[model samples]
Target: MVKEQKKRFVLDTNVLLHEPLAIYSFKEHDVVIPMTVLEELDQIKDRKKDVSRDARVAIRTLENCVGDAPPDLLLQGVPLNHPNAPDESLGKLAIFPDHQVTFANPVNLPGDNNDNRIINAALYLQQQSSEQIVLVTKDINMRLKAKGAGLEKVEDYRTDQLVDDIQFLAKGFCELEGDIWSQVSKVSSEKVGRDTYHTLMRNELEEESFYQNQFVIDQGDDFCAQVKSVNDRQLVLKDLSRDRLMSYHAWGIHPKNIYQGMAMQALMDPEIDMVILTGPAGSGKTLLSLAAALEQVVEQRLYDKVIVTRNTPEIAESIGFLPGTEEEKMAPWLAAVTDTLEVLHKQDESPAGSLQYIMDKANIQFKSINFMRGRSIQNAFVLLDECQNLTPSQLKTIITRMGEGTKLVCSGNLAQIDSTYLTAVTSGLTYIVERFKEFDGSANVYLNGVVRSRLAKFAEQEL
Candidate 1:
């Protein structure tokens, strides 16, 4: 009896950008590239700002691997007829010689696009040879279509798997053991006020406490953390000067809706020097952080100014040059900040006058992360938006910029990260949240259930 040969697989264009190294993912199996895939790569060859350029480079690298090989050995260009019955050039390359390979365009039987052509080629090859064929794609719709078209196997490019069992530390409490609790109790009576004491009590589980916002430090074997409740009463943390802590408050901000109470409690902390907010898009991470900064700067006068900056290291492509001055260049990125400010202005009694007054007072400064290299931010409310895009090195640079008496809040959506080198599990936001989990001076919050338009939320889930 003869042994059956293993199946071959063909990849689509989008799969490569979604995962650049997908070409090498298949092991000990034959890989085929229909000629149409090369044409798609050529169309995106000159795209400088998009990941398409990276896809082009990947294809070029593969081409170099096949350099000067015999036509049959290389699976070089093959002729295939399109649905329009025109002979078109499609490159064919054999990744494995022991397996039989053939390429031909299938009949354009309804709902056929460039991707369909590639699938049809695979189908034709499967029928011609004894080996089965599988289609790999990142396009969900394309995958479904390929299945409906009678392809035996279809799979997504899964190189970008998120870390399993990942949990955010936003809304939970910690516990401490007896020894750790005794140590904390001793320090609680020092410069810390009553609200801080109570918050620590609420976060303390036996002997453990939730420190900062993100960390639940082990207080030895006997302690744990617990969340505090105020019986419908919101608690505000008083400043060291015995003044009410002020925060940016505005309507239509989603975090204000879900995280307002927690924000209030966090701001009351005298020990927490940094806070991190992570959520999906429209979850109000940035707006809430800004609100807290504004309150500290304008109302409490705790900070000299509010400094807002973002690093566009990931989405730097197609950001385009800003017309006119540097401020104009920054306007597009600062649009969200302006929108939040406008909302705050509308809530004020004298919208125009109050905005101008705040501007004149130098209470708010919008700057780029590039300009933050040599600066030490002291006695200010500093906000870093879109921090998920920052590489770990870049994030470290931003965090180290904090000067004495300064409070820093870094906010970004882990799911919406555009950085090719990072994912929700490995992004700087996750790294910070995990690393700072034990620090009493830091806090982390993850906002779920986006408060954007009803349709937007639906699209997020459905899409």
Candidate 2:
């Protein structure tokens, strides 16, 4: 068999910003960084934005990889070495001087923008090199432009993407047909404390194995249970009352569907450290998360304070120009929490007073995702909203900030992502939902219905 020649990958700036260590993601393939990408990173590194941190990290990563090489060696290529894989030889890292490319080529882009310059670099390499030259970028338009410019291969940077399609994302629950007992040939039942537990073979359900903390409900039957433990042979299910789950209330807010019921149950459970909610807009994700936070902080006194934070698109660079304190600056983006509060207390004799009372009682603090780094948050009910716009690395930064006794509730609409470099499958919400589905202390729920309003439901379904 003929050994295939190594392909050279020309990375765009957004790929580095999306994942700072993206250079190592291509395995042994040669990685090329166009000077245009570096120049763009340099310009963005000084900006007062959350992405600036990523830009700085990407710059530092390039420095660490090829900093010590001489000019000729840098142009030629520096050997890429990683400590974890010392035994395996890796590819070389090279910096392409795209700005100096003045030769006329038929496939060259006419524009002088950074994107065009990067595409031109790939074009130059494709002409000069014998190996396949592929342009890797996160921007879809750039990919199209690269392909249009006659680049043989153009691809998206998908090393961080855990799923290819959004349909396969974990829904936190599985609905079974008919009664669960009808499918099970044998079962072992026992009682622990006030909860009833049943153990059956993994294949007794006649479906895929369930993950820990995943809920199982009957389609037309009254059976409802949660998987407390899962082994290779059998699963331990905690029998739950369907009526009881439907009756669960958090700060006077009751679940309208079994999905929300499971979400509320997970949110209110003291044993659960993280709860992820994903669904369409008006699916009660924000409302349920806020209600659960308020219940834990004010009514139940399980937590000291309620810290409501989110990845605000505007807050990246314009937050400094906003008026008042950090919390006040975050007010506009966090209006969903306030709106939910109003709905929760609309029946009060003094709605305004009740709103203020709950706000003060819960000690709610609106925080920005940019300011959440390097701080340990403990004994707080954290509601992270609009997380669909975040990347996997960005979400990891926030999740790692949680200290002891912190309960994090992440809610987002995958279909409503605002990030240009992210999609429903690559969103951080989808990443965490899939990553944490098997964790015993974490639970995820995809709210299935639109409970906001009739008009909103119609819009969500039709438009």
Candidate 3:
């Protein structure tokens, strides 16, 4: 009988950072770590920076799981490669004896980079063993290089799948049932006060029925106190603040644009402590969020200040070392923020002083991700722009900074993530939407059509 051969797999540096447990992912199969890959891991692990902290943690976790190695030998297994090696030199290392393991240094690779060396090592393994060899990495360019070099079996270490639950709620409408009204009323008037009524109105419920208002509700009972509504094309907010209602109409936003209308409703919702907006490039997520925030600070006087921030993960190349003050360093990325603010200012018919006066009184502040740590924001309208660049952990950090009576508005394009480790499904914006859908204090809106231009919408669909 011919024995079944075990497949051999080699991992690149990114694959390990993405999923350190990948070594154990393949059951009873041999895993190879090229010398160059180890060198790359060592460099990342040695970095003394905040950004590399997570990478260091990953390395430590992997090392803890798979013991230490010998001083002289580059590779070690469950059974020592050399039994006669000194006990002090041969540190404890986990090696699988049932699997045949070997290391190779490929002499001739097109490039001397770590990625190329990994590919070459996999090729060498394939040539030496009867079993198939698979190369695993999270780098898109490296995967392409592997394929171009005639390595057919390459796989992405799918850490991106961990956050897939977020994508399911990206474009869906949540239902608030009929019986939640009574339960809400049972809470103290302060707890379920005017904000509760505002939530109901924004949900587009019938003004007549006590429970018919379309809003988020927290009910103590499972069956009797439930919130339910069918997903509809148009979202209507009946009793919004006058300023917000006027601003929405002025911006040419209405039920005619269903998705934008829904997003507007969420933005206008006073009861919701958190709102998440996700869409593509031309969806007007930023403009709508800015408009709503302006209305609250300028007219309603509900919050003490308006705080705007963004995660500026570079789109392609770095913008280079910016030369300026803190605000100047942020100016380029914040042009869109200022543009929206200017539009709102332009709509004001009063003298020029009115816009400046409002800005001064409301304490409007623009911030970047660099200054967010260790700050507690209170009674403020906080806008997290371009949140798609944030990881789930990073988003959690930002959200936890919200203080009492503060409302957080997060907007992003799920399809346009700029972070090295994040994608549509794995971004913090999508993460919040999925986890908070059932929470009464949270609302999500997905804007579909582009409001930028007719040509832009056409380009979005066709190109």
Candidate 4:
């Protein structure tokens, strides 16, 4: 039997910008980089945008891969030296001179567009090579154009995509049908101090999935508990009173629903280092997070201060041009935080004064996500909002900045992702929720309902 020929993948600039080390993802397949893509990367590397850093990293990654090879050898092929790739799985990397490719074919798209040039390069490869020639791009329009321009194959870079669909993403809570006890054959109860814990055999609850810090509630709302620990044989759940959870207040803000109650619990927990809240618009994500931050920072004095930051699409470029301090500049984007504060203090006689008083008392500082790098945030509550637009790499950069005695709360609405390069399934919020589900010190809650208003809820469901 004859062996199958290895495939050749032509990567787009957006793919590299989306993931700098994407070259290593196509194991045993030849990776091709067009000259147009290199030029695009060069142009983007110096921009005052967040993607500029990614562009530079992608360029550096390419340099490290085929930098030492001769120009002739680079056009031919250079063996990729990925440390993790197996000997049989190693592939070659080549820089294709798309500019040199003949554009005589009228079917060939005009060279005026970089995307068209990249597509044409892949088209040329398909005509010249027996191996499968595929175009890998993150841009939807580019993919459509490549396919329409007669490319044999095209695909999105899915090396970092954790879930195939948004529905499959972890919700951090499990709602069992009927009574949860009906599904369990046996359970052993224990009391430690004032807390009640129940240990049940893992096999008994095989139908129901459990993870560390995952909340479990019954459909009847009679029983609610949090998974304290899980092992191969047994699962331990900490009993939580549903009434008490509903009554739990944070900076005078109470949960509107059970989902928010769980989120509030996670936010208020001193043991949990990270809490991720994901939901639809007006679902109390920002409100609950801010309320909890204020409660922890001002009332409880658990942390020294409260730092609120979020990813603003034009922040990298527009921030410098905007007037006032960093906090004032960030005010426009962080209006939701201020709006939530107003809601929290609307009943007060001096709402503006109370907001200011609380802001000073809690030492609430609004920082831009662009400036979060290299700063050691200690003894503070960091509330990262609108994180759905961040890539996995960008999110990692911010998460690493968290120092000791700091609690990080990440809240985002996946349905409302604003980044052109990201989707709900590929979002950094989804990535971390799945990645940290089993971590003992982290908790995640997907606030289910829209509590902002009836009109907002109707819009969320219908529009």
Candidate 5:
């Protein structure tokens, strides 16, 4: 019997920065770290950003993997899944040969940069060994470069992939039988703790499984409601129509569409620790989130205050430096915040100084994402806007800052991500929504309406 040789994977620096634990992802395969990768990691080990933090951590992990061994043992590799190892090990980690080796064919690259150097090492390894040597990276251009250089194997690191495509993610709506309207609207119209109660048939359940806070719409009878509770075949609906809102008005910005109504339902639920909203431009994602925060913080006094955080892509990429205090610097990037505030003020018809007064009295804080690291927030409503621009690691950092009695509402339009490394499927918003879909304390809704302006909707649809 012949046993198949395990593949040897060469990881780019970006993979480690994206996930410090990427070493273990190969799972029983042989992993190789090019010397150039170590040099790059060393160069960026002192960086103050998350990339540097990841580099230092990965270097430490690699050092631990190869602790005090013979020079030959490094190339031979160390067990990743060894029972005697301190961490979980599913594969083995090794360092590529330091000596020269020939590639399959002659090649020339545009530049001798770090990425190209890694590709060169991978090519050399492919020629030296009969087994497969694959170059794994998140950078799209690197893959093309490797392919152009005649590398036989290249792939994106997807061990942590939540869903294959963005379409596979939850859309926040569920359909029921046509006759469900009669049974739900008439029979279970009675109120039960923040929502209406209805017992559905096991046949109605069928193959459809409702998420903890997913919305339900039986448009046959104009039925729009939220799933209050899910118990086997028993389904409870919470009406979020005009009459069922917690108060007559939520910070004077009312939910205009059924999706917005669902947003309000999740936002107002004290039990829901996290809420995700995804939609297109002018879909009221930010407005609904801000309004709900105001309602909870100011009207109901649910939390101590409201803290807003945004990954300002425009600011992060261009200009790089903003002069002045943090709030003043954030103001230019938060036009949406200003606009939402204008709408709220116009609807409330308050005095000229009232908005600022409420903002001050309620302790609303506009914070930059850079300083968000290592801060613990408790009893606050945190809104992370424009989250599509964030990476999976960036989103994880933000979410981990959450403390007790705090609600984190993240909203972003997946169709409008600005990051070069992020897409609709890989954006932080999609990552969180898919990962948290099964949790009982997390809820999400996708809004498709663009009620801000007809022209805006036209642009979203046509342009």
Candidate 6:
């Protein structure tokens, strides 16, 4: 019996930008980087943006793969090692067009487009190679063009996707069994302001293996508590319904919806180092995160300053030559940031001209994602809004920047991704919610309610 030939994968540029180590994802299969894609990466490598940074890293990784290897290896292949895609002998990575192969562009696409060139390279490989050849890209249009050009083997890279289906993603809460409430009341014994809590038997639901800081809410009744701590035969439960956090207003704002209420509880808990709020437009994801951040920074003095950053939309390929510095370039993009602050001020009922002082007192400063690569943030509250557009790799970069005594809130509407490549199931918010499900001090909420205004709610539901 003859053994089957290994498959070949030709990766698109966006896939590399989204995950710098994507070459290793093709297990036991050959990986190909079109020379055109390399040139595109080189064109944007100097920009101060996450995608550009990823492009440079990928270029370096490719170079390292070629280090000390004979010139023939560039056309043949080099071994790759990645823990996530571990198969030591799985496959090899190489640069496509080690010798030029002739191919034509899709008639509808411009000949000068980089995407068409990449697709043409894939076409050459498909015609020349006996093994299966696939074009892996995140761009929907690129996929369409590849298919139209008769390249049947094309797919989006799924290595970073945590879940296969959108419905399979956790909604950040679980329904509690009826008897557990009584069991909860038995071990109940803690108070914070007007709130009451309990510590249930850890073994009571040990088989379920509930995640830390997970909300156990029952719409049928008022029994709501978070898994405060999980130890042998004893699990600490903190009340969510009767907690003082729900009734407390933050910077003259209160949680108007149940989802917002849960978000506030997680934010106010010092034990929780990270909180994620996922919701649609007008669902108050930004407003709730802002209120919680201000309350912690100004009222509780939990942090010295609030660092607010508006991550660039994924559409930008490079930062280019803006006339001003980082902050000045980022200022125009921070309209949403300032608008949220104004709403918080008006909610506070502050007199005219008091809003500016409130903002200065809170010590809010805008930080651009361009310069956030190597900084450590301590004793501060960081808000990354519009995070749905961020790739999983970019999100990881920001999360690693958190230092001691720092809390980060990632707010986004997963349904409204602006990036041409990202989908609801493949977004960074989705990745974090699923990847951190079992980790302690990390909580997430799915806010489906729209409570901003009647008109806004109507648009959200009808439009």
lDDT of 4 by residue, 27-79 (tens): 88899999999999999999999999999999998898887689999998898
- 12, model 6: CA deviation in Å? 1.6
lDDT of each: 0.59, 0.89, 0.62, 0.91, 0.78, 0.79
Q: 1-463 in candidate 5: lDDT tens per residue? A: 9866789999998788767778877766888998888888999888544456678888988887788867788887877754354565366788875334454457735335878778888888877788899999999999998999989999998876788988888877775666455543334458768656655553454435776677777645456666756767567666655345423347777778667777787888899999999999899888888888888888899899999878865654332477777777888777788778777777555655777887886688888888788999999999999998887878998999999999999999888877766678777788898888778788998987898899999999998
lDDT tens string, model 1, 11-128? 7876665444455555445667766776777776666444554576567656654666777766633222222323533323353322232344543334235776777766666666
Mark the regions of model 4 whose C-alpha exceeds 4 Å error after superposition: 1-5, 83-89, 103-107, 206-208
Following a full C-alpha superposition, what root-mean-square deviation does model 1 have from the true structure? 11.9
Which stretches in model 5 have alpha-carbon errors above 4 Å? 1-5, 45-50, 81-89, 97-99, 104-111, 177-195, 202-208, 228-248, 313-321, 347-352
Quality of model 6 by C-alpha lDDT: 0.79
lDDT of 4: 0.91
Choose the strongest candidate by lDDT: 4
Candidate 6 residue 441 C-alpha distance from true site, Å: 2.1
TM-score list, all predictions: 0.51, 0.95, 0.64, 0.95, 0.87, 0.85
Per-residue accuracy of model 6 over 1-463 as CA lDDT, tens digit each: 9877789999998888888888877778989998888988998798645567888988987887767777688778777766554546668887876236554543333457788888877877777778899999999888998999888799998999999998877777776555455544356588979766787776655246667888877644466777767767787777766344458577778877667778887878788899988887888878888888888888889998988886666324434455576555666777787777777766456644666786688888778776687999999999988888888988998999999999999888887888767899889889999988788868988887899789988998888
| TM-score between model 5 and native | 0.87
Question: lDDT tens digits, residues 213-310, model 2?
Answer: 99999875467899999988998999887888999998889999888888989999999999999888999998888888888887789999999998
Cα lDDT, model 4, residue 80 = 85
TM-score of 4: 0.95
The list of candidate 6 runs beyond 4 A from truth reads 1-5, 46-50, 82-90, 102-113, 175-209, 229-236, 242-245, 314-329, 347-352
Better of 1 and 3 by TM-score: 3
- Model 2 earns a TM-score of 0.95
